[model samples]
Target: MTISDYASLLADAGDYSGRDDVAHLFPRFLALAELKLNRVMRVADMEKTATVPLAEGEGSLPAAFLEARQVLGADGRALRALPLQEFNSNGTSAGAPIGYAIVGAAIRVRPKGGENIRLTYYAKIPPLTAEAPSNWLIEKAPDVYLYALVEEIAIWERDAAKAGAAEALKRQAMAGLGLADERLRWGNAEIVIGGLTP
Candidate 1:
């Protein structure tokens, strides 16, 4: 569904709950729902790869980055994730980096040098807005957005019963989305147990 559809549904919800007085806050509810979704949902659709150029072993993370999955060197070697303290104490030897650490919004690679790094990470969901209208989450699972918005609105209106019901539905929708993502990612893969295939 597009942002308009979501807004319309939210309006209907507000009217149904006898809370139309808070209609001006529908956009805020949607924004809050998106924030909650970003914190809770991690699926294949959110995975992104970015090439970051380092200057003196430090580079800014992608704007959409949520969490890094892997960091690779220019030579395609995976860099080990190191603790910030350990990475700092590794000394400043100019060359290729073997480890990296996330420091705030930047990545610090040990063995200070200038090179390009590939970062694979979970990205923030493209929020639904007038400019963007919709995203994968909306297209694939509108119920998730619906229930999440409902929950937020219910909370704002101080309706415990509505909030509780919406929260339960939201959880179910989120779980279903996760399950669908898992099936798409690994349903055909073979399972291995110890040294044997299962």
Candidate 2:
């Protein structure tokens, strides 16, 4: 669904006068929903990988970066992730970087140089708009967005009954989202090992 479609749903759920009123508020509600979703789950859509060159022990993270997954050198070995304080104190050893720290918008690594490193991370979801058209949440779990906006709209209108209904729908959608996330994270396969009989 698109942003306009979500606005229409919000108007219908809240029984608002028209879409124009809700249209203006769509971005705000969508932003709130995005923030909540970003914090709650790490979906496949949020994963991103980039090759960035470290200059003098640090390199800038992508604009949409939310959290780091892993950092690897050219050899494809995982670089240990360190706290900011530790990285600050031990970031200048010779040879390849042994670890990295996310400080501000940049990633600081040990033994910094101009060498490129692969960064895997979860990125923030892009907001939906008329120009932007759609996002992963819209394509995957649109009801989650719909219910989220409806709940917010109900609170704004001060309708207790409507807010309650919207809240229920939001919870249902969240449960579905959790299930989807789990399935995506771990596929439907059971691991069995047999070594000794008891």
Candidate 3:
């Protein structure tokens, strides 16, 4: 659904709950829902790949980056994730990176040197707005958006019962989204135990 449609639905919920006085807050509700979704939802739709240039073995993560799934070197070798302390203790030496740690918004590589690295990560869901009314989640799982918005509205109203109910529904919708993504990723695949032959 588009942002307009989502806002209209939220307004309808607000009216039902006698919250028309806060109609002006619908945009805030939408933003809050997106924030919550970004924290909890990790479906395939959020996955993104980017090539980041490292200067002296340090580079900035993508602006929309949520969490890194994998990092590969210029020659396509996978780099290991290291704890910040371990990475720091490794000291600075200009060479190929063997591991990396996320330091704030930037990525720090061990044995630092400048090179372009490919990163696969989960990216934040694009927020809904007047100009950009829809996104993958809204298109594929409108119910998730609707229920999440309702939960936000419930919280704003300070109604615990309503908030709990809306949260339950939102989680159910999100589970459906997760199942759909799993099916897309592993379609008709049979599970094998320890790779043993039947």
TM-score of 1: 0.88
Prediction 2 TM-score vs. true: 0.80
After superposition, which runs of candidate 2 have C-alpha atoms over 4 Å from their true positions?
1-20, 159-168, 189-198
Q: Which ten residues in a row have the lowest lDDT in candidate 3?
A: 1-10
Q: Candidate 2, overall lDDT? A: 0.76
lDDT of 1 by residue, 54-158 (tens): 998899999998999999999999999988788888756666899999888999898887899999999998877756667888778877887888899889878
Across 1-198, the per-residue lDDT of candidate 3 in tens digits comes to 243455555655565455777668878998999999999999899999999999888899999999999999987889999987888877666567889999889997887878899999999999877667668887788878888888888898799999999999999999999999999999899986786675
Give me the runs in candidate 1 sitting further than 4 Å from their true place: 1-22, 193-198
TM-score of 3: 0.88
lDDT of model 1 at residue 89?
85
Error of model 2, residue 116, in angstroms: 1.0
TM-score of each model, paired residue for residue:
0.88, 0.80, 0.88
**Residue 118, candidate 3: how far off, in angstroms?**
0.3
List model 2 lDDT by residue over 19-106, tens digit each: 3466677677767767777786677788999998877877999999998898998678799988777776775567878888888899
- Angstrom error at residue 184, model 2: 2.7
